[model samples]
Target: MVASSSPANIDKSIPSNEYLLEMNIKKVKNILIANRDDRFESLKMIDDIQGLGIDLHFQHEIDQTLDMIYKECSQFYRYYGRDPHEAALCFRLLRQEGHSVQESFFGNILDKEGKFEDNLQNDVKGLVELYEASELGVEGEETLDSVRKFTFNRLIELCSGRESHQEREIMTSLMQPRHKTSRRLTSKRFITMIKIAGQEDEWLQSLLRVAEIDSIMLKSLIQEEMTRTFKWWTELGLEKELLKARNQPLKWYTWSMEILQDPTLSEQRLDLTKTISLIYVIDDIFDVYGELEELAIFTQVIERWDLERLEKLPRYMKVCFEALKMITTEISMKVCKSHGWDPTDSLRKSWASLFKAFLVEAKWFTSGYLPDTEEYMKNGVVSSGVHLVMLHVYFLLGKELTRDKVKLIESNPMLVYY
Candidate 1:
């Protein structure tokens, strides 16, 4: 039997269009004004310029093409303020032709205000005609679709204002995935298998889809059922022995996944609440206790969104982010329902704290010196403490506390296992 392909294999096929555009744009800046004869050679030197899956039969080098495109875009905007089509066209052309311009140029035009402008539409139409003539395949469809969905979702939130907890409950029920046969899989072992299988077959695509769906459904269930139960349980200190066991890396991964996949646990509020709590604990372990190389791998995976990076992550960190993404998405949805709250703010704070902790540990790791345990403790405390304060501020402003309270609990010296 053929083994399934991993995220790393699928990742290798995905184009880094954004990075490519940036490189081309830099080259354009240096060579755009050079003699037109030299321009063709310069353009030819750009790797995958024609293979970018876009049509570009028009003159290879527009004299002052970069400046002219910018000027035309500005004129279109002035004539019809906030038109996205024209701006998108400008970006499309530059990107198609291998220019490294700002994505914001196009992104701003697609913004709510820019989408309404008449001239923008005219420019977009013109550009589309040009693209069709040149046979440039759809270059930005996925990105544009994602952006549009986000914008529309934001607008819906604005119109709906704060939804009642009851309303969220209803929404969660509608979004819940139908339960399938439960697979008793260890996350660590599962990750290893996926990595190995993925190398042999195209497994990453299915894995990504399943993981995303599972995360969303699991987060919803956690928020709906377990939040309050876990909160009270923690407050009562009822699970000292269980909590101790839960603190172990392998055990924590298993329990968390169990809670997410539990058939009986189906409420978004409880699910989200539990997820938040778990995220706090896991974030602490990876951020404060994990080795420097492990943390660095985590950082790179999150920043680059690369499956290869994900594969390189310590098995534990991979499990953590997959879990984190689910919980964070649920919290973000709730925040969107509330209006005006940035659900991601808390997640960002957590990431920043982790980043700081990584840096300090990295210094120690590089120098081959063991950091003073006291100093490491102090650093962890300060970083995590700041994150908690920010989280509290959001909660105070009416954001649901999706994160666990253990983050607020003082550190016990005995718990320091690193």
Candidate 2:
């Protein structure tokens, strides 16, 4: 249970590891600065930096490099793009940086049949990079679709032939491509793979060191956040009061951290963890603890946002309702102070909708009614608590609060559906 050293403690007196972390960050910056004009090398470096999960430290550099690359090569790349690895890497990296790059660039690798050329199978690195990049395609991009299928089949076939580090990487990518997986999870594996392979390039070695140090420091920060959040959870005494509720403060904290992994988002992560914890408690109330009649009343009281109706509920339900109100109020006040807009109405309506959705399921369970697939999915989406979480996220991030945007979010836009 010994505490890890947090990055916050790295002021004038820094730990040796923290000092090393700083020096290596500078080393990375030097490498990035040196390679600024080399478009292909710059793209690969950015890809490596991101793959190593150290991109946050070099975001500005990465952005500048990508901007330069896109400006210089956008049109040329469309016609005479580099090899598959370079073309695919550039396309993925540029699109990720919000550049309007096209997938047609990949068509260069296609043969006369308008399919990925069979010769790409021999280019394992190209196919791997292309496989990872193909995930960025939107709906109806037939070229990307073909690339995905082609690379997947070839990668799978290639996996059974060799057990090398490269093959392992292919298998890993097949399971979770760069575009689909979180950098935090994938970066550690990449670092370990490079170490296992004994890569000796100064840039690669320095990048790995940065990733290691950053991972340790990031873990420390998250540990501290979790400790602070857990203290808040324990102080509420909800665990003892609502015995049947899932007492999982750490779980909630981890979930929030995963969603908002930026180091600067500590406050947002903590707030989100609290909201998610309360959601679990409320869910347990509706699902496991409360009787049908009590759940009905509870849903009604939540929808009404009525403190007066608390007397009619069980003590556990009251505890949950009060906790919900307190957190909602805290969030609303903070948001109002920061953004000059009170989100109380929007927040309440979201919670009310959630509770109503939960109540629908509670009634269904009580009456043994099986809803049709469409009806069930529609309600299930709301009860999934994703919209509620995203609503809080919108306010917590201090996004521009337009009246129309508020209305759009409250209506549960299509983004929340997916």
Candidate 3:
């Protein structure tokens, strides 16, 4: 056993913070292991893990637990029958885990009139849970829509009468449901809730410790990412070169970070932020700087994706075009290596489509022609740059790529509208 000098048994040192992080993760996993049999408690712990932004560390365990829970409980809704909080919590968690839970799961909470029972109006905890669960509703779920309104209005009324921590928490949830809020932002609130409630359980304490450590580590990593991104931006010199273009790399980085909060997505976040920044820069060129003729030429250049046409472009257009080409190529190279397919042409076409849409808007603006709402929205969807951004995101993080999935993404599906 004393083979410390062996090549394979070299004594390597983990940084103290990293060591601490590993220990905390181990503690949290142990807590999950110990409480694996308690359905309600296990679900609550998973929710806490997610809310605390440490679910990335236990994704497999969380998935296994959810799958097991789904299997063990045949009559899922009836299992948590008569307890609104339990029922709503179960519904929300299962739905979040990609289970096709029915809206009628809350049937016990509904009155004969097919509306939520009046008694639930006064049950603050139940109402709050129901409000959060209702957020997972998709198109045409009348029951969830009604539940949201009922819970929202009751929670609003309840919070209006008090200035307590619980009231603040309720107001925060009412403002943005738990599912919609940023994990990092909500984790702070979750930590505050735990401390205020004086939860003295060992698992809660471990969860809290892990959350605190994670927050610190995440902050450091984000700072590093910001520094690196800023360095790249400065070296790109777009701000100095393209004076009229927006230079909001920090804001762009915020979008990337918030949208992709998992620490493991650092590279993807940077690529996304870079793509977004270019979108803004190119958008500004079209809307603010470029003459209609210049924008038209720029659109054609992008459509062709030929740098040989660079001689015909104006100085500013050339700068923007080169930067766009470079970024697109860099992303394509990375994606091709990982996904085993070149996305270069697809990426170019996406940008070309965006520019064409922008040119349409530019022409309309120049001629003082305001299209009808339908016409404007139809064009606006393309000009929105959502498809462009999402295209890049798909290629960057897409695990599996089928012809159908590629077609769906390229079609600019209804997902981008929302």
Runs in model 1 deviating more than 4 A are 1-276, 279-291, 303-308, 362-378, 392-396, 399-418
Candidate 3 versus truth, CA RMSD in Å, comes to 4.6
Candidate 3 CA-lDDT value: 0.85
lDDT of 2 by residue, 1-418 (tens): 8666896655666457878988999998999989987778888888888888788889888888888887888674663354888888888898877899888788788877887676677888999888888898889898889889989998888887686876877888899988888888788777876786548688888888888888888988988998899799999989989887899888899889878878999988999999999888889888898898888888888788877877899888888887888999999999899889899999899999999999999999999999999899899889989999988998898888899998888886346666
For each candidate, the alpha-carbon lDDT, in order, equals: 0.44, 0.85, 0.85
Off by over 4 Å in 3: 1-15, 73-75
Q: Per-candidate RMSD vs. true structure?
A: 22.6, 4.2, 4.6
lDDT of 1: 0.44
Which lDDT tens digits does candidate 1 get at residues 1-418? 8766876557656545444444444444344345334422332222112222111211344435544555554433343224343444444445555555443444344447545334333342333322222222245655445434443343334334446743442233223211211233323234444555456532232332333344454456545444555554455332342233244333333344443444342343243344445545554655355676777766666555556877875655665666557656766666567544555655555555555565665666668878677787767664454443335334433434443542342222123322
- Return the candidate ranking by TM-score, descending: 3, 2, 1
Q: In model 2, where is the ten-residue run with the lowest total lDDT?
A: 73-82
- Native RMSD of candidate 1 (Å): 22.6
* Model 2 lDDT, residue 107, Cα: 72
Scored against the true structure, residue 49 in model 2 reaches a CA lDDT of: 85
